[model samples]
Target: MSRLYASLFYQKQVTEIFSDRSLLIYMTVVEVALAKAQASVGVIPQEAAQSIETICTAQIVEQLDMEALVMASEQAGNIAIAFVKQLTAIVKASDEKASRYVHWGATSQDILDTACILQCRDALDIIEAQLGNVHQTVLAQAQTHRNLIMIGRTWLQQALPITFGHKLARWASVCKRDLARIGQMKPRVLSVQLGGAVGSLASLGNHGSAVVSAFSRQLNLTAPVCTWHGERDRIVEMASVLALIVGNLGKMARDWSLMMQTEIGELQEPAGNGRGGSSTMPHKRNPVAAASVLAAASRVPVLMASLYQGMVQEHERSLGGWQAEWLSLPEIFQLCSGALERTLNVLDGMRVSPEMMQRNLECTHGLVMAEAVMMALAPKLGRLNAHHLVEDACKRAIKEQRHLKALIGEIEEVRQQFTATQLDDIFRPASYIGNIQEQIDAVLRQAVGAAD
Candidate 1:
């Protein structure tokens, strides 16, 4: 593999799934199916199955140079033509009579499509496991800060008070929903394909259904209801799901990265002993982990477009569209899995600055508590009238650079409606975060219930 490809998540040690185990399982399934098919047709002795199995166990790359073969196919303007040549050589060396039955009745699409599905399954497992890790981390954070109060912003301005627990709970809920979506789609998306050329299976004769069943059983995959040679809905669905997962994780990363800014240091990515660089500036601690998650998250849409375009397969066998997907789908899965896993790492070691959060809330000198005053007076003055009153107080607080409490004391309407003692109760930031505990509990309940 090229250095660039090797550096990617799909190609690395952490989850080198698509390139290694997935490919091996796919080829093994295809070769075994061919052997079983030959036995059914009486073309090869049943004992020959062991020989075919043995050959498959030998390293596929050792027997045939896949890199050269793939490149040769591109040079020749053919699909699997090079693979056929290489497999023929391997079989010729093994046993001539049994060799003819190696890829009997199978077309390029059969092997390629099944292999892609296996890759998808492997990627899904890795992504799900990483998401589960993220879910647990978020849950723990939510529990830790269930009562910790902070300002909530809307349209880039403070609107009300909220708990850090509420923020973490919202993230957990999004991931929980996506995890459910993945579970719902896995069975349909990972189903196998065994139809021969033209998707009719006509070459397999009357035992077509039995052959497909046996083939699926051996591969530990679900056989499709019918040949989906040109039906690209499942591929599109799976890729879209992956894109959604990345987008959600991106939202989380974006928020955390922004909060880690020097001016608004309410949070920080986990800092290690040798975490970040300050090549020119001595007092710099860059948010490299947060930046990495952000970069990974940003790449999802373009990868997803490849799958979207592949949805428009040309005909019964779309050579161009299917070939495009063969390259794009695995890359999409790779990027998503990488992003998800890294995002988990970020959340697991994330540091919360409660003092910083409180300081940011006070940056505007208690202007954020205006909403509490509005709600407190709503029952007495009516919501619309109280809103306008609070609006005036907020403008004065900003212009005169005065605290909201001072502005309220200056307003005659505010003094007439409430006493200084009453003002203290309304100004409490923690009071405005209504039902945060309830919501956090609800999310934990859902995640735990689903797990059970």
Candidate 2:
């Protein structure tokens, strides 16, 4: 599929997650030995872990029948079963000792949960790095455009004047906060899941903890305090965090998409060579990149809600809830990862139309400066009286289709409140942006401190 189609609405995230094959191989080895080594302890033979470990590292995706595996997983009622069946064949073909050790003393949950964690962790690494790059790119734009003044809107209408840099700074600040949230969640998100049959690791006895520590250490994962067979707070927390990131990216994409509208024309994503668009509408260059980010972000919350439901797992395990996770967790990770990747592209290639911004500042027919004029005239005319006078003059200007300057020049009350010279200062959008740069700086410093 084209990049546009994938980013917008059609994406095969499930395929992306398992298609790596290398990650799958690692997951199979880790989950299998984690159960095997914990089960027989001194009797299972340490060589089993070694052999299983070596074979896992050697397993190749190119040699396997993925479609068949997926279909068999459905028949077996789980993916882990299919994975073990295939892996057992591979190991048996090479080493009988390793083949005997494969998937020993483990239920399907043990392998599935650990494998999911490992996959989720890999996705997180990619997301964290991408978020960092996005943050820096937005910060650079914020600094570069710090003085480009434009109108600030609330509720789709102009509220006040603000610099383009200030807006970019806000974007950077939101992204930085997301980065911090992800950092706070890493330890928990990366925690190892070694819960055996009933989650108490009752099958492993005293060596359960040692084996867990070893398993986590070998995989560079954080070992959970106890089995979480029935506790899904960690997964829920991860889903929530990812959704938060999605929300941030969505807001950014939505705003940029709005700014790129023909009527607005204040911003644009770079039009690169071979960039795809409508063939018939030669003049139309849609914000496809931004649209992709927004589309990916929009699906994240629904996927995460399923994970939230999974948090209500019953007893030692809820096949119902846990089964939901098998579909939901990977979907969440893949959706979020796709959104982050698209968002980074948007930030990296976004084009700022400072000239257009200045032009659009006048698009509102100087109404955006109404607040500034009111403030300037408030002390002179009394607050309520000043509001009434400016309100009347603004209405007249709109009706007559004339500039506020011309209408105010003819208004006796406005003339009495302020001179033409003073009115010019009041109408200056740049002069009206109050301490915007300072606010930006403060937000940046706070983000940096929190990140540090």
Candidate 3:
């Protein structure tokens, strides 16, 4: 929780949104909104609501002692208790009548939960924008490399040929799904939390529901059917979605790091400004962004799991479960936002070496094309017979250190089955990549539709 490495591991914008000062400001905004809502339903005097609003400005909230508030929170069981006390005192100095109505019927959970929702709204906006940037960058890469042939691996060994765009399109499709999830989750997670003590607004009499509606309207958040003092699905869902996004980013980073290996050299993270530098070696170009993303990906799921465990709260209000979220949720947002930002950077500046890809594709010396040759011969010989023949040729090709195609040319069955011209076409990398363009196009069309 120390901010020593915050700039390196968390997005600066998101970090500020979850800052201590921002939290105080959000809590103050909630109290102000509550006052105005109560007044709208005639639960409190309009003049009193006006005075509370006018007195509790950002400037006034800034004057409150944060260090004292933190110290008091340790003894008070939660920050909102101390925060409400300070806010009431501040309003008392300006107008005595307004002080009486400060945080009038609302409890600590209501204020704190509403403030957290407000924070999540802002944090989600940043994440959505970053995801959009990454999605667009991936689409561009897919479009640009649609036909750039490369070797596709299975179990880390060359299996067949595929276009690099096919790989990028898969990332694009996942990003589109992530965007859709963000859209679906906003309404549920952005709902205002307002319940007087113990999940019911018993103190507000008949005006409780009205105040809830008005408060939600004032904040531009959805009002739930009832209070969720003990229910924690919304918070958990937000963490789940964030974890899902981080997981996808980790997958991309893993592939990128693998491809950036010196033996592969098919791709590289962008170089400049002393990035990807080595501390001890002069010839190192590390996948720094990818590594950062992977670190976040590894860390966020465990944080998200804590939230899931926090879901089993006691009735009305939790003893320890509810408080667990205070520590887990913001950290989840911070790590997820960091991962999204790093992914965008990598996608934007990634270096794709079509030449190296082609070279690596051929490094196997037609061994990669064995499947294509086998399929071509499958019709002449029985399927099992063709598999055996190609299997034998593959071994001979490796032992003789010669191309599989040349070795296959010497086989009597292959000579009788096809001409040299046909065999030449069988080994072409592009020829073996099946329907990759159509797949990429389908992904791109879905991405465009999602944008619309």
Model 3 stretches with alpha carbons more than 4 Å out? 450-452
* TM-scores, one per candidate: 0.93, 0.89, 0.98
- Which candidate has the top score in TM-score? 3
Q: Per-residue CA lDDT of candidate 1, range 353-406, in tens?
A: 999889988888888888788888899899999999999988998999999888
Q: What is the C-alpha lDDT of each candidate?
A: 0.77, 0.76, 0.91
Query: Which regions of candidate 2 deviate over 4 angstroms?
Result: 1-17, 20-23, 32-43, 60-68, 89-98, 274-276, 411-417, 450-452
In terms of TM-score, how similar is model 1 to the real structure?
0.93
Q: Give the RMSD in angstroms, all C-alphas superposed, for model 3.
A: 1.3
Which residue pairs does candidate 3 place in steric collision? none
Lowest lDDT 10-mer window, candidate 2? Answer: 6-15
- The C-alpha local distance difference test score for the whole of candidate 2 amounts to 0.76
> Against the correct fold, how does model 2 do in TM-score?
0.89
The regions of model 1 sitting more than 4 angstroms off are 1-15, 20-25, 37-45, 76-79, 450-452
Q: Pick the candidate with the highest lDDT.
A: 3
On residues 277-376, what C-alpha lDDT tens digit does candidate 2 reach at each position?
A: 6788778878887776787687788888788877787788786888887667766666677777777777788888888988888976888787787788
